[model samples]
Target: MPETAGPAEGTTAPAFTMPASGGRTVSSTDLAGKPYLLYFYPKADTPGCTKQACGIQEALPALGKTGLTVIGISPDPMKPIEKFAAKYNLTFPLASDEDHKVAEAYGVWVEKSMYGKTYMGMERSSFLVGADGKVAKVWRKVKPEAHAAQVLEAAKGL
Candidate 1:
């Protein structure tokens, strides 16, 4: 796939609503006027995905101080998302993008290759939306382990 970018900084964030873990629904409308982090990952319960989720969980207190809500989006349905959150004790919303609508809207759904094979999947990417609902920062092909700290630093600006 050709290289592409998500919404640029200062552009309004694309709106979305997805089913989340804990039988909840996360909607951009409800998050309106508040900063939030929307992260897209390839799969739930995998090593990288797990690390990324836990890191955000670890940063929750500080993130909460910044008043930044976080939502993890994946193409997997709610079952695995619920399991992953429970296993890791993640209290944030892990939204299910089973139809890939939100991922595509955010430009995180893309072509991928592994072991000489190619497929379509969610990229490890994140977008921090400011309180005004504009994109504040974008991290593409994110490093799982350091993601939370990076986001926390940026969230302080929101």
Candidate 2:
């Protein structure tokens, strides 16, 4: 397997605090003593991001049963984040990392190229932080359609 950025399994997840939709804020401290998922996406309201968010939304009740809290993080501002959540009826917190500090700490911020133009962007990645506060799993370059199911399977064991 190729090496990926961010905390590896068995390591402590990076700390973060940011504004989220629904007039909420999420932080590493707030999630302590509980298993949670921090999923990073490129943008809000985009096709792939939409699919991922919707899939997670559909699985929220099931995920809740597993006691796994899900938070979606993106580099977009809170405005777009709020709109996206409202439009999709996503109740879970969707955070805005406008400065990308959280994304950088998680190692999900990286360089990218599109149409032969190089730029920086958020990587489609996730970190599953177990109740003990260490990362139990890490998924890099995630496939939106399968993300929630994959997360659900892993969370069931936690």
Candidate 3:
């Protein structure tokens, strides 16, 4: 299980590297010195997760104008992520955190209960990292709909 708490705003974003779709890997170092969004979701291709990802994908053009790159993270393995990206035509990175190390570092990996069954899973969360590598904002228990627009607005201030 992940530690009980996530990084607070103004703290330096935790660093991590994970395999991603498109035969590539994404690392925190890749986003350093730039404003970026790191979002965590439970699974790939599922309804809510897909909506969340597609929402961000839809906002990419607007978000790009602000120079804020976005990357989605999940504990699902590579194949599923590849499928998800291809299915949705996602232009941003979707990383696979099979070991959940990155999610653990971000404190988005946690115990969750669904329909009375408890298990560890990735929480629906997002972090906006400023150019200085400090976290500018954190969103926990995010709703899929309208989240991209909210994050886009928040990024405008960064």
Candidate 4:
């Protein structure tokens, strides 16, 4: 995996365009004028990822009231993402970064080790983009449980 770098807080978010589930394209520009939460995960249908996604889903109404839009991104292809969304009844958009370009750009893809095995994959993380397109908060190596609530708290401050 390639090393990732990003602008500091209060700096403009790097521009990106990726294929989203449901055959749509989502771009950084498309998120203008609204605060958005961009979360990166390793794969779809996994326990942690499912918990994180469902947590976000359950908090959608509260997040919406706070004027925040949530988007989940993963290295998985669109087919799995579509199935995951349907299975979880996820209302938010989920982007597929099969090429890992977006994940690399966001600095979420990295070398990971588990059970004494090493491999390259996404390091679950989340970023809060303010209305001005600047990164307001970044949660690296995020924990699944209470993540949505934590993000909601941060979004409230934005």
Candidate 5:
């Protein structure tokens, strides 16, 4: 992870192009003219990450009703992400940031401490980007279990 700052609310989201599941390229610019969710997670196939992904998966209908598309980002490579999505039947796109470049740009990759040791990793977070391509809301240090419902509520208000 590199030292970078997060995009503030009402500011344009940092543009990125990353490999999505199934070897497709997905870019922030591709989402122009539509509201979308960009969620950053530490890793795939982990307990918390899986729970959060599934939660968002379950809430997709409501989010779709609100006219928002959800996309998940992580530092893991695409192969693992593909497996994770398959295992959980995820319908949303998951982008791989193997170098953590996009994660750093979003400010989700940062120094984290666990078990008294400090290291750089993706900090679980999410951003709601408006149809105009600016951030509408940010959820930092998110708790996985309730994240989807929380995001849904925020999207409804958007």
Candidate 6:
């Protein structure tokens, strides 16, 4: 797969709506006029993804204090997302992008090579959308363990 360019800072974020855990349909419109974070991970319940999700959950209070709403998106269906959220006691929304449309729009869907086998997967990434709905920051190929703190620090600057 060719590398696709993502939205740059000051560019409008791509719009999307996906089925979230708790039977909610989360849409970019729902976050209208509010700054938010949209993160994409490869899969639900996997080790690295789990660590990433939990880190965001742990960082929620501080992030919330900054008035940023965080949402995690993955190609996994709603069932797995629900399980992942419940298992980790996550308070934020975990949206399902089973068809990968949202991930593609965000440029987080990409081809991957692991152990010499190539496949399509969601790249671990986060986008900070400002209150005006433009990109504020972009984190590509994120490290799962320390990502949330980094995002919070950036959000504070926003």
Candidate 3 local lDDT, 10-82, one digit each (tens): 9999998888888888887988799999999999999999999999998999999999989899999899999
Tens digits of per-residue lDDT for model 5 on 1-158? Answer: 44337998999999999889866778878888989999999999999999999999999998999999899999998889999999999989999998999987888889999999999899999999999999999998899999999999989987
Q: Candidate 4, TM-score vs. the true structure? A: 0.94
lDDT of 4 by residue, 25-90 (tens): 888898898899899999999999999999999999999998998889999989999999999998
Model 1 spans with C-alpha error above 4 angstroms: none
Q: Report the Cα RMSD per candidate.
A: 0.8, 1.5, 1.6, 1.8, 2.1, 1.1
Better of 3 and 5 by lDDT: 3
- Comparing 1 and 3 by lDDT, which wins? 1
- Pairs of residues at least 3 apart in sequence or in different chains that clash in candidate 5: none
> CA lDDT of each candidate?
0.93, 0.94, 0.91, 0.89, 0.91, 0.91
lDDT score of residue 130 within candidate 4 = 97
A best-first ranking of the candidates according to their lDDT comes to 2, 1, 3, 6, 5, 4
Candidate 5: lDDT of 155?
A: 90
Against the true structure, candidate 2 reaches a TM-score of 0.97
Error of 1 at 149 (Å): 0.6
TM, every model: 0.97, 0.97, 0.96, 0.94, 0.94, 0.96
lDDT of 1 at 6: 67
Worst 10 contiguous positions by lDDT, candidate 4: 1-10
Which pairs in model 4 have colliding backbones?
Answer: none
Q: How close is candidate 6 to the true structure, as a TM-score?
A: 0.96
